[model samples]
Target: MEEKLIELVADVLEAEPGALSLDTEFKTDEFDWDSMKGYAILVTLEDEFGASITVDDFIAAKRVGDLLGLVSE
Candidate 1:
């Protein structure tokens, strides 16, 4: 799930798969993470994992690991 999530995020953010880690912070200048990208990620996650991610949940996820937890939950 971690690897898949990383790849999903990378794809959504147009980043290299090797660039993301669980601890990596989102919305940083390192990645082209903006509101649109965030929404895309959330929608993708919901589609991929069958999890309902709220906007508040996405905003609360400060890092990749947090997103992992949300989906896993």
Candidate 2:
């Protein structure tokens, strides 16, 4: 799941596949993860994991690990 998460995030952000890690912070220029991208991420997560994510969930997430937690839940 982590591998898939990494791949999806990297693809969405147009980042190198090997560049991001679990501890990678989303609130940075390196990730280029603005709110619009964040919404895209939520959409991807719902489609990928068949899970519903809320705006609160998106707002509370500060890192890739938090996204993992969201999907896992």
Candidate 3:
């Protein structure tokens, strides 16, 4: 699941899977995560994992690891 999530995120970020990790912080200097990217990720999560992620849940995800919970739940 983690590997798949990483790959999904990397695809959204236009990055390589190897470039991302659970510890990777979104909207940081390393990652130019904007509102568009956030929404993209949210939509992708719902589509890929069949998980319902709320706005609050998305906002709370500061790192890649944080998103794991949204789907796992």
Query: How do all models score by TM-score?
Result: 0.94, 0.91, 0.93
Backbone clash count, each prediction separately:
0, 0, 0
- Candidate 2: pairs in clash: none
TM-score of 1: 0.94
What TM-score does candidate 2 reach? 0.91
lDDT of 1: 0.89
User: Which residues of candidate 1, in runs, are more than 4 Å off?
Assistant: none
For candidate 2, give the lDDT of residue 58: 81
Q: Write the per-residue lDDT of candidate 2 for residues 1-73, one digit (tens) a residue.
A: 9999988887888888788888888668887658788878889988999988888988988888889988989
- Clashing residue pairs in candidate 1 are none
Model 2 stretches astray by more than 4 angstroms: none
Q: Candidate 2: worst 10 consecutive residues by lDDT?
A: 26-35
User: What residue pairs clash in candidate 3, if any at all?
Assistant: none
lDDT of 3 by residue, 1-73 (tens): 9999999999998899998999988667566768998899999999999999999988978999999999999
Q: Locate the minimum summed-lDDT window of 10 residues in model 1.
A: 26-35
The most accurate candidate by lDDT is 3
What TM-score does candidate 3 get on C-alpha atoms?
Answer: 0.93
The C-alpha stretches of model 3 lying farther than 4 A from their native spots are none
